[model samples]
Target: MQQCSYCVNFTPAFQIIAMTKPATLKEIARRLNVSVSTVSRALHDHPSIGLRTRTQVHQLAQELNYEPNKTAIFFKQGKTFTIGVILPNLSEEFFSMAITGIEQTALKHSYNVLMGQSHDLPELEKRITATMKDHRVDGLIISLAKDSKDFEHFNQLDKYNIPVVFFDRIPPQKTAHYVSCNLRPGISQAVQFLIKKGHKRIALINGPSSLLATKERMEGYTAALHAKKIKIDMGLVVSTDLSTGGTEDAMKQLLALKNPPTAIITFNDYVALDAIRYARRHNKKINQDLSFVSCANLPITHYLDTPPLASVEQFPREQGEKAMEIMLQLLTRGEELKQKGQFFQTELESRLELIEP
Candidate 1:
């Protein structure tokens, strides 16, 4: 017998083609000699269905790899059983931790999540939001991008009766459901700690001025300075896009002053890391010549040879979990409940540790 050129064994093409199609409820019913409705009810564990019959249906479904039609389910329930999450940057440790909480909570509620990263671009964020709408997600969880100014994209979701829950970097909308950490106490404490250590000239390397978190942190910084009777120095505070290069530029500018700040506070760990590198290259030692503090106490800080003076624990994971919980409530509850809107303010304890060289 002549062997086929593609393979040594002669496998029939029809067999390969047959395996590609997925098993369906109708197929299961046909095989089990039951009605399609009976199979569906049994799979759903409907109370009307007999226990033995349900068990038989489940066994046959496992054997045939039968999967329910989600489209039909959606039609019946008026929900997609899916949630959409939009983040500024997926690579950021804060967002990464938040995603874990969001995903875990979503899974517990039998809902799937679809994630989109905007990379801090307004246009891209709009596009991603549109895509989420097209996917017909039941609800949304969002952290606004750094440069996001236009919120009209979200209006479409509102028009379609989709609930939105904001976390971390939320938008300016007052009526929206959101979860955020109260940054004032931690930031104020950090500044107070620095002042207690006799550091009068302090510089702030902040994220975009448009961001809510940045605004809050700046307010906290200024309040602390005012409390200590120190005049607010506008020149000492630098705003950046929070990119590595942006942070490095801000550090350079601060270091070039005739009387530069003895201490620096940054937006997040990545910005702090960049500032530290820049300071070291310019002959400044961490915790010696220059004291540094930042937000988002990432795990890497603990492992660093020379960690920052302190890092404000923002509890990204908890923020994510709370946002998910809020979203779930909005989805499960009626439209009237969603319209009421809820805001969760998480006041995580601030952790401050001064590193000694």
Candidate 2:
């Protein structure tokens, strides 16, 4: 009546015990009184395998704790069933949520994800891409670094017959398919909210000048200002790299101006949070002394001591899913997959309330 150490929940000693070899498919097939091919087809969920027989084979394998050798499967199929994911940084909650969506979709399709971070450096980004290529990944998903102005790093993927897809912070040249929020309507909505509050002088804290999102958002800000018959005040807008230090510098510059803006729009919620912190240093109450709005409306922004006057919530999860769907099709199909490559866009603008007054 002796039970195995694992079954008895014993803290077994590694030196005293021998490691048990994993059960193989052949052993399970023998136990089930079935051919090896039949067991494999059943394990793979082959449509040809009868449901009743498949259930019996699966139950037998479970009893044996059978595990298929993935290496053998990969060798036979000539596919690693792995995808590489490159992001500027994973600390940001926005990228984390987007990654969650990508992981979910990749798992459902029985593919593995290889992750890499660029840390917003161009040379590092190139190195990561090269490493992923060396791994012979089946596909790649990327959100380019702030300094990645050239697409040559990703060009290697094409040379290796690997598909690359972009999302959120995409490359400068849209040579491949990408999925991201349309920033125009979101920025327009945020600016209009400030105008509705009777604030004529508005300022923008944008991301790096090289980013496509920054350019698009600036355009939206300019268009909104023109529509309201307000001349674009070049001094009011401060283009800074998206960072805490950058945001603080921008806020200080605006506060120093003799004619400071009554409202400010930021590249993202994180930037707005930094602005709020800066405003507190100067004894300026947010939404009272100055109205604030930002893009990428993450939940953390809402929990701040002083939340933004409004925010724009883009569908990052959907963007991730759409990017994967396109990459999958392109890898499996050919030029026919181009239909799915069409940009998938969504928008969500916060309903501004007079939180201050």
Candidate 3:
């Protein structure tokens, strides 16, 4: 009297067959009163299969809980309708929000996403690229890791003709279509705001030197100071890993300086939050003793004890949306696909005033 989930009759052997054995074209043809070849063509919604008959066959197959074998579909179509996403880490709020945008876009286009986190490791990024190629993802979206300079890992995708678009943390080389914030302007805005508040002695907490964002931020920071006639002080610019430990260590060093900066600009909200906490530990009041601003703001910054004096809000979701849109256009429009191997650049940049006490 036990019930089998897959089969209505619930016979042990039939249950095994229903659960483990895929419904074949012949089995479906027998059930639908059609030949095996007719069933095969109907499942693909082939133009030769009359619409009414195809609909009837498909409905019956659905009722029987039949699932198409993905391997067979890939072999026949040469496409998996699957894309891959490579990120530094999904645990970050910014990247997680970007993922939501990517998912919505992929679903709209009837494509699947395969995600891999490189964790800022070049070797892992290479492995992920290889795996996605083996799986034959139709396209790829990536935010390269910090240490990734040589893009030979992505060169293989050219042979497969799978397009790769770079977003957020992209490389310096102009190899792929990219969607990102215009960091120089954002950083310039943040630094200018701090200077307006009478912070002539300012410092910069930056990411690694090799990173594209970090280099652009540094340029902006230097430009802002130079425009204001403030001499560039090498001692005040601290390059940190942007992770908690490295940021904390950098904060200690910056604060311990002979003439510590009264204001600091950071790479992202997390580094800014760490700076605030580190300042508090040293008995320094946030806005009074040490004002802080960051380039990319997130939701968590608003909940802090003393919110950032200001933050630049780069629209990460919009970046993700636009990146996918470009890739989809390349995939669907045959004529437009002639623009393949072209680098399309789109920038999403915004600034927000956090206005802390």
Q: Pick the candidate with the highest TM-score.
A: 1
Least lDDT summed over 10 consecutive residues: which range in candidate 3? 334-343
User: What's the lDDT for residue 170 in model 3?
Assistant: 81
Instruction: State which candidate, 1 or 3, has the greater TM-score.
Output: 1
Q: Give per-residue CA lDDT, model 3, range 81-125, as digits (tens).
A: 998999998988888888788878999988889999999899999
| Model 2 CA lDDT for position 104 | 92
For model 3, what is the error of residue 157's alpha carbon versus the real structure, in angstroms, after optimal superposition?
Answer: 1.1
Candidates 1 and 3, the one with greater lDDT: 1
Off by over 4 Å in 1: 10-22, 28-34, 42-63, 338-357
The residue pairs in collision within model 1 are none
Model 1 over residues 1-357: C-alpha lDDT tens digits? Answer: 886767744466667768856789888889889999999999989999999999999998888778778798798898998999999888888899999999999999998999999998899899999999999999999999998877888867888778888888887777667888767777888899999989999999989988888988898899999999999888899977888899989998999889999999989888999999999998998888998998888887878888898888888899889998988777777466755644444444545545432
Q: Write the per-residue lDDT of candidate 2 for residues 215-265, one digit (tens) a residue.
A: 888888899888888899999999778888988999989999999998999
Candidate achieving the largest lDDT: 1
- Each candidate's root-mean-square deviation in Å? 2.8, 5.3, 3.9
Q: What is the lDDT of residue 179 in candidate 1?
A: 86
* TM-score, cand. 1 vs. native: 0.89
- Model 3, global lDDT: 0.83
lDDT of each: 0.86, 0.81, 0.83
What lDDT does candidate 2 reach at residue 315? 72
**Once superposed on the true structure, which residue ranges of model 3 sit more than 4 Å away at CA?**
1-22, 31-34, 42-63, 333-341, 350-352, 355-357
